[model samples]
Target: MTSQTTEATPDGGQLRVSTLELFFDLVFVFTITQLTHVFVHHPGWDAVAQIALMFGVIWWMYSGYAWLTNEVAPTSSGRRGLLTLGMFGFFVLALAIPDAFHGSGVAFGLGFVLVTCVHTALFASSGGSSAITAIKHIAPFNVLSAGLVLVGGFLHGWPQYLCWALALACQIGSPYLIDTSGFEVRPRHFAERHGLVIIVAIGESIVSIGVGLTGRDLTVGLVANVAVGLALAYVLWWAYFGIDDERGEHALSAVPPRERSRPALFAYGYSLYPMLIGVTLAAAGIQMSIAHGNERASLAAATALSAGVALYFVGQWAFRLTLRLPRPWTRLVAAAVVCLTIPIGVAWVAWAQLALLVAIAYAAVIIDDVITLRTGHHSSYV
Candidate 1:
């Protein structure tokens, strides 16, 4: 029961991401907004850990769908229904985030269970034999991790963390637990899908600036500070979109399928998880920073502001390394430099700290461009 329509683009060699896929992503970004607010409402160590644990589990399935649909697009009515159900699951998770560690844990877990189930069924039904085989090996791990999340929801303290930790461990180990060499990855759709996700996350960050703007008088300084925040978002957007995404796609496409699992998984899955976290953290930071542009930062705001940008570069460093792109010294240096600004953020005004961080980000982009020119691999593998 596939759709009468083909998933292929008019050009025929690649698949265009469907409108339904884009609609599904709207829910995913909503989850990002909710996760961002978890920190906004409660800025502390607990909030940070909860975000880490929750994101790890949530992303496993989110990225899993990207992989699923790369091979099996929801061109069919049946697949679309299943995907829409999965989207509802994500919306439930989004609604649960503020209270995930409190009263809403069960609902969060239930949503996760639903997401996992739909993902497995959707992938299992529509894939070719090899993909089905891959999903067969992968499905049990997914089920077990979802179970842990549900069990963790039942508990209330350190015990809950342990269950979720175990769930995260299972997800991390699943790729190694089985042979994933049989997994299919078409470079164009895969890269485009991920690129769209990344952009959505960045867009959410910009949305946070607006959230921060609420209730503030429209002043010149406030408007200027907001402008700088947008600049930071733009530079981050350009860094990924300018050359690296294309490079990533080109790198994966250059490799045969048997060799793609590692690079593809790292580029989109493992590496982007932390990168997305970084963006979320930065968004929260921007929200807080914009509210007090003239005042020195609080500990949470300082850490989020400095470390968020640093974490993004660290993830980018890993992404480039996994793709066997140039050594990514630029990203490494940018990461280190941004981290050093936490204390400065605490000591100086929020605008000052943000300006400094954006400067470092802009510098990294210039260096990356220079690297691309020297290697002549700006858009190619080699």
Candidate 2:
């Protein structure tokens, strides 16, 4: 269940992600884009529910590959070639996402099923009969889920929803079908891989904001907005990688396999909750700035932006709390919730607006960090 080998730290070994990993990640970028677009088009609680379901699907695919790559990558040229082939299916599935539930669910389902099969084969080919047998336990379930997706794609309304619902259930439960304890997953490597991917997601958010900034005509307010936005991004980066990531890395480094696995799943793997929300809120904030003033603000938009900021901090809190690291992160959560209240309060206050709310919320995060530092409460600090 454990291995003597330890992966090199980011500095000790190459920090560069491999070409194949980048190519594989490209598909996920496309998938996130599709989910964003689809969610935007619908824009309500129902759409949020559907997007949540789709996100589960996305998370499972990525999680399976991550574990597989951690175990078997660099072991064989043959496996690497098949990985490239699997990435192709992922690309197709991503491209089919916007239409997955809309126009061509069949195309999406088939592509997804194909990707799952490819991954299943790769895992089965891992080491011996145990690996094959372990993977096979989950493979049939994947096939059944894929069939549901295909059938769901063909139907309309509730029937389609039902198919996807069942499919998602199967997908989420698939991990339980195997004695995952036997997998030779080095916790440090797995955690580090996911932590890097999250950075990639956050980088995309910065890129999105940068792109928006470039196209707009600059005003005094616009300049201030840009500064605040940049500051906010930096704080988010600090919140994740600053000390939290180190603790996660250390936890994985110190713990036995069974205990170490939880951080990867609950802490790193669930990061989409924050990453997605932060990006969406930050994007909406950019558009709000570009739109002359807060004239376009709606309760829905305000709530979305507020929820996004809140979730990112909550995720940070959860990441720390789950690992029982240097800090409890309770103050961080309190600050985040207090900051998030700005948007709701703005709805009632004449002077309060989205831009101002963002500025205040972001400032609070910095203040909270400063206080934490001054108090020297973090275990990592000592």
Would you estimate the TM-scores of all the predictions?
Answer: 0.95, 0.80
Question: What ranges in model 2 sit over 4 Å off?
Answer: 1-17, 74-76, 127-133, 210-216, 270-296, 326-382
Error of 2 at 101 (Å): 2.3
Superposition error at 93 for model 2 (Å) = 2.3
Measured with C-alpha atoms, the lDDT of residue 377 in candidate 1 is 58
How many backbone clashes does every candidate have? Answer: 0, 0
Q: Enumerate residue pairs that collide in model 1.
A: none
Global Cα lDDT for candidate 1: 0.86
Cα lDDT tens digits for candidate 2, 33-140: 666555545566766666666666656777778766765553357876888887887777778776666787777777777778878888877644554665677778
- Please report how far candidate 2 places residue 361 from its true position, in Å: 4.9
Q: Which stretches of candidate 1 lie over 4 Å from their true place?
A: 1-6, 9-14, 379-382
Model 2 TM-score?
Answer: 0.80
Residue 287 CA error for candidate 2 (Å)? 4.6
